[model samples]
Target: MFVETEEFAKRLEAMDGLEREAAYEAVVRWFAENSGRITHHMHLAPAHTATTVRLGGGEPIVTDGPFVEGKEVVSGYAEVEVADLDEALKMARSWPACPIVEIRPVA
Candidate 1:
């Protein structure tokens, strides 16, 4: 149940108005309705820099860039313990905002 997007991340950080409160309530209600199967929900912040690194005998070299660029970047994720991916997908489909959901198993 990972909601991944920079836009969403920004919204979460600045949720302080009436509309934001309503939106938060709606999301909470949705989660509450499906609380029976959700064990937890977590958010992850993505690094904006490239992860590629070069190792050499002389010195360690680092690159200043990201692996890829796109209009929508993964800002965070949510972890949901469910029966399976199908159940997770169903829950994700019910999300009111940010239609994108990245489902992955916890290690």
Candidate 2:
């Protein structure tokens, strides 16, 4: 897990109804345009939290927040496939308001 703060989310949330519609449309267009690199995208549930199970037969630890303690919590994720690490890093850096990009290879 990683953490960084970006103001883009707050700005988008502050938009009025019509403005939000326009913004959503633009995002759809952008996603379509970058369909190859974007691959799959979905927003994480806002009420999501983490629960830890202990191996010592002890009580499980639960938190009302992210399981990982870091400067950033993953609000969402994207399954992006790029040419190589360099390309992946470049694409990650290009995100509009991504404060932290956690790139982990799926097993």
Candidate 3:
């Protein structure tokens, strides 16, 4: 799922220690609860650490940043084997952190 990186940072910055801890626990709980469906998951590093390689051109051009320049960056991803899109949507709707979740089929 793609997360709004800026919004996530702002939320954490606004939270106190206790609130941050609770938020973290909530995320853990969510994963635990959905572990059955989640076949694989990963939390990516910050956007600044990303490396983009453009192969569309004849020569590959490597860039030292995110794939695009936008307020939202894909902070993490979860690979779930659901029955259908509806089920995937249900899971995305319950995400507690980050304001955006983009559910796409695994090609």
Against the hidden reference, what TM-scores do the models get?
Answer: 0.57, 0.62, 0.89
Give the Cα error of residue 85 in candidate 1, in Å: 2.4
Residue-wise C-alpha lDDT for candidate 1, range 1-84, written one tens digit per residue: 443467776876787788788887887897788888777665444656446466775787667654445546554455577888
lDDT of 3 by residue, 20-80 (tens): 9998898899899999999989999889999999997899999999989888898999999
lDDT of 3: 0.89
Give every collision pair in model 3: none
- Give lDDT tens digits, candidate 2, residues 1-107: 22334465566678899988887676566567667886788766542455544445586654566565654556777777777888878766655443677888766
Error of 1 at 56 (Å): 9.6
Candidate 1 wrong stretches, greater than 4 Å: 1-16, 44-68
Q: Which structure among the candidates has the greatest lDDT?
A: 3
- The local distance difference test score of model 2 is 0.63
Question: Least lDDT summed over 10 consecutive residues: which range in candidate 1?
Answer: 43-52
Per-model RMSD to reference:
4.6, 3.6, 1.4
lDDT of each: 0.68, 0.63, 0.89
